[model samples]
Target: MKLAYFPGCSLHSSGRDYDKSIRMVLGKLGVDLVEIPDWNCCGATSAHVTDENLAVLLPARNLAIAEGMGLDILAPCSACHQRLVIAEEELKKEKFQKALKETTGKEFAGKIRTLGILEVLMGKVGPEAIEKEIKTPLKGFKVASYYGCLIARIPRVKTFDDRENPTSMDRLVDLTGAEAVDWPFKADCCGASFGITQKPFFHKLSGRLLDGAGDFGAQAIVTVCPFCQLNLEMAGYKEAKETPSRTPLPVMSITQWLALAMGFTAKQAGLSSLLVEPGRLRETVSR
Candidate 1:
């Protein structure tokens, strides 16, 4: 199967590990990814706040390009997936359609669909297919599947899993032979960009998530959003430093974990770039 891949801004920059793992794992699953050419930022977090039309148009252009390619889009980042899905919904309205045409000189045929990585993994490539490719099952590892806010919180748009209690990522983690701990913060906010704008509040929110995961006996926190991973790692790092007895929970992108189980090296999955290393998880994988 082939799809148009949109790495968005974060995946190309802060979320490189996610991009690497998604490409590698999907390639291993016999799925081909054709990147959207000349793709721009999806206007996540900032664009919609400043200018709604600009936010819609930003992803609409990418959607138009993907529509021309006649392939569904696989946007790995949660924010990107949400933004693209929002644009698709907006395009259904005549005003947004006219705006898109006036701005980009292109027509949106609404011929394709935008999917998050979870949707692609669970819907397109089932866990059974992935199970067949696993070379090193993470049999005893325990992780918390963090979904953050954007992936499934959009009320109007249809999401693959339950909005409040998502199990898609948990199921994927379980397929790796790792146990996805039943934790309360799965769909909670990860304090997002607040880590930069409002440090204290970000710490408080992210700290609660880390504390919750740790209390539930989670060895690591797995996520699908770059901001979530970054924020959680940042919070975990500071928390560990503040309290010597506390160990920083390794925050990993779900694709990175899948890549490890599929026999890819840590370097190949960009694990070295993470602020909090998965030392214990690495040992378990080696064993």
Candidate 2:
């Protein structure tokens, strides 16, 4: 279970809960995550389309740092995973590799392998291992597993599964003895930066996810990325200016749910870090 873990900038800042929950749950599973020393930003939302060289170099520097450790990079954030994976793919090409080498002073050999923590949990740890550790199964829970654009999107560059209705996360949720609900807006975008910029857009989008979850009688909606969590959870604050009444649905990172299923303390899973008040819905999930 030893892997090079990259938490990206957001995890340390606005998304510390994602990092906390991940480390806590993975620790309970006996997984060793060694952080990449001196790791830089993955340039997730901004750099790619705006600054060409930065898009490659930003992730290239992180990839090179991971390469130095001689371990595969395990990124919990889907955006970071996508960016790093894209960097690995693009840097392997001749023109991009030349630019990366010029900026980083090290020729990236593409030895750096990137993985979403979800991938490791589902495929590496497998459903059986997760099931073995479940102390309180979510027997009655009908959950909507939200896989945002980055992890499964971006074509063959960062993609490893069917982008349309990828079932790994949903299956993992189901293996915890819960019913993976066929909620609408499963493959729909949750309006990432539009959460701040074009917030009105994702308000409707986030509400759609919430409406779908509520309609299916889901206990909670689970996601792997902080951006998705923010977009869905923080919608009302911004969207209220336009159209209000956004449902305050609880969106837990998969790590939070896993730790809860394993019967770990809420403190251990950083469940207290959630913005949405899930306490009211305890009976819905814990029954």
Candidate 3:
């Protein structure tokens, strides 16, 4: 149960809650994550667009470091996972590998197996195992899960499931006895860095997703990516302020929601900090 873990920049910064909860929950599930040494930022949004070389090299460097340790990598953030995966794929290209090795003095076989944290958990433990661990049932909750772009939408890459219609979240929700309703916007974008550069624009996109969730009778939107959580809650709240809604759907990381179902404290699960608390869902779990 030991694997190389890449938290990426967001996990350490705005997504600290994600990192904390991930560790706690994994420990609860009996998994060990060994952080990669001196791992640099994954280049995120700007890397691939501005300079392809840097985008590939940055994650490649981390993969190289992981390979050195003889451990497969498990990435938590979708962006980081995508970048690392993309870098690994790029290095596999005969031309790319030769050029990269000569320039960077690094050896890459694309040998490292990169997995999204969700993939590892859902596969290694299986839905049946997770079901047994649920201390409280989320019987009354209706959560619409969000997967965002990078994790499952990259064309031709190893998307864990269908990009447009994902079942990973739905499966996890079902294990906790919560209903998982079909959400068309499950694979939609939340406007990455645009959260700052284009706040208004991103908020509108986020609002559309939340509005979609509410339309589907969702009590909350569960997610694995932090960027998705940030936009889904903070931006959705702002939009709800401008336009009144019956229930401002709360945005929750899958980790947080799972912790809640397992009866973890509000502080431990980072619930109260959310602008729109999953109060209704909280009541459901307490019972």
Full-model lDDT for every candidate: 0.90, 0.79, 0.82
Q: Report the number of the highest-lDDT candidate.
A: 1
Q: How do the residues 61-142 of candidate 2 rate in per-residue lDDT, one tens digit apiece?
A: 8888778888888998888988888788888689888887787786678775998977888877777777888987767667
Off by over 4 Å in 1: none
In model 3, the Cα lDDT at residue 13 comes to 78
Off by over 4 Å in 2: 236-247, 282-287
Write the residue-wise lDDT of candidate 1 on 83-131 in tens digits: 9998999899999999988989988978999998999999999888989
**In order, what is each prediction's RMSD in angstroms?**
1.1, 2.5, 2.0
Point out the higher-scoring one by TM-score: 2 or 3. Answer: 3
- The window of 10 residues in a row where model 2 has the poorest summed lDDT is 236-245
Better of 1 and 3 by TM-score: 1
Ranking, TM-score, top scorer first: 1, 3, 2
Better of 1 and 3 by lDDT: 1
Relative to the true structure, candidate 2 reaches a TM of: 0.91
Give residue 88's lDDT in candidate 3 (0 to 100).
80
Poorest lDDT segment (10 consecutive residues) of candidate 1: 278-287
